[model samples]
Target: MDHDVVLAVDIGGTKISAGLVGADGQVHRQSEVATPATRPLLEEAMRGLLTSVADGASPRAIGLASAGPVDPPRGRVSPVNITAWRDFPLLDLVGAIMPGVPSVLVGDGIAAALGEHWLGAGRGVEAMLGIVVSTGVGGGLVLNGEAYAGPSGNAGHIGHVVADPAGPLCSCGATGCVEAYASGPSMVRWAQSQGWTGPDARALSADAARGDAVALAAFDRGAQALARGIAATAALCDLDRVVIGGGVSAAGEVLFAPLRKHLDGFLTLGYVRRLTVVPFELGRSAGLLGAARSALPTAQFESPTPA
Candidate 1:
């Protein structure tokens, strides 16, 4: 139980991924599989995923990052998208699968921030926020070189933050939340309401790239809301940098161009205006490495010694 390596797991609505990681920030023998709908199926898939990745290498500790809202105190999870796992005791399940090793759990947003800060886009920043702009908007704070999850492990959940009072309603039963404007579906929904025929965010991005006025306008609007949220976070956190990732962010300049412009308009204070926004450098590996790093301190490698 004295190895530098740890078991890292990233569980989401659509997929489950597992890997073995070390302090060097490398994830090896990673394996991924579609997430099943039922809890039993999920456990079965997870076991397979872990077994495939672990091979004969037993990690000392386990770090798990899952879609939330999660209760770290009780080691439970209730992800919105994963219906069968309401208040599921994730820690216990992981412990059962990989016994005799300590495990740590955190929201994926926080894990992403830690990952980006340790080795990705937020590297070397004193205070930062990692934003995932996908189906939903998620925010994670990395303040003073460490993650700040706050009480209830929900400090940086910025999706519900009011960015526009007159904006659309959010899934969290709030109006004008940033997620209602900048989330991929939200942007596409707005575009469709305006006669843009694209079915998803990807098509919208393509249309915007080709100079489709309505599509471009959709991105512009989404960027405008995202800018408001980012500026608000920067103002409050006095952040040195912000890193954006996820599917919608992959739209590249289609998203960042207007985002920068709108962000400039919202940034008032000089100190906050200095915050630099960038895309995540680690891509999909961010959460994995983040979980690995977070679990490293407690990692207790034993048994199944690398054969």
Candidate 2:
């Protein structure tokens, strides 16, 4: 390693992105590829991306942020989106890729939160909720100026929080989860049930932008469910800010309008009323930066306990 650079990895179901982040927290070079569903193909795709991104520069440390169920005590990760990686030795494998370099593993949500706190929308907040509302809902918290991943390193799973008792069942076999109502597919499904006939959330957003009643109602419903979760999170954590990013978040005013309205309705407590919610500042780069931040040495940031 020539300098204190971080080899950051952002692993998701759709893709795996790797970057060589310099000491200043900027990614100088990066590479990404589709995530193969199978084990062997996944390994090949991931390794190639890592090698390509390194670009002949050895990194001092590696930070990996993968969708989880991170086994902190075992250094393995079982991302709910990636079925091939059930308790996969991600930390060990990444470390092995650059022998003698230290590696850190954390949940993707937690990584996003850390990244935001350091260089994005949550830059100045003491308590923040960072959420991703894409194919699924995922979230993490930075409380009292430190990332809180709990004992097993998967604490801020706000997506699974129950927003309505009468809501539909989630893929995790539970009913009334925030994800069941707020995720892109969930909103689309609800719209379809109401005879909207939309093919996907993207089209739904476009229709909503044109003021289609049914599409607007679909976003409204998802916003309501998301509101419940956000309000509850604020109440519990006394949050100062909420930053949301992902594909569904791109709906802009169509989603935020109803989200703010429902959030206000649910904010019965005066103390939590001032919480600010906004779009993610870092966008697609947040996860990579957050993963890189995990390798930096500072009290403002901390890594999940090694499994």
Candidate 1 per-residue lDDT, tens place, 1-307, comes to: 2255788998876567788886678766688898899989998998888777776776778889887778998999987657899999999987888888789998888888899998899888889998877767777899888899888886788777899888788876789999899988899999999998879999999999999999999999999988998898888889999899877889999999999999888999999988899999988778778788778767544434231
Give candidate 1's total backbone clashes. Answer: 5
Which stretches of model 2 miss by more than 4 angstroms? 298-307
**CA lDDT of each prediction against the hidden true structure:** 0.84, 0.84
Candidate 2 versus truth, CA RMSD in Å, comes to: 4.0
Quote the lDDT for 93 in model 1.
88
Q: On a 0 to 100 scale, what is the lDDT of residue 98 in model 2? A: 70
TM-score attained by model 1:
0.91
Structural similarity to truth (TM-score) of each candidate: 0.91, 0.92
Candidate 2 lDDT over 47-160, as tens digits, reads: 778777776776777888888768767899887768898878986776666777778888888888889988899987899999988777888899998888889888888888
Give the per-residue Cα lDDT of candidate 1 at 132: 79
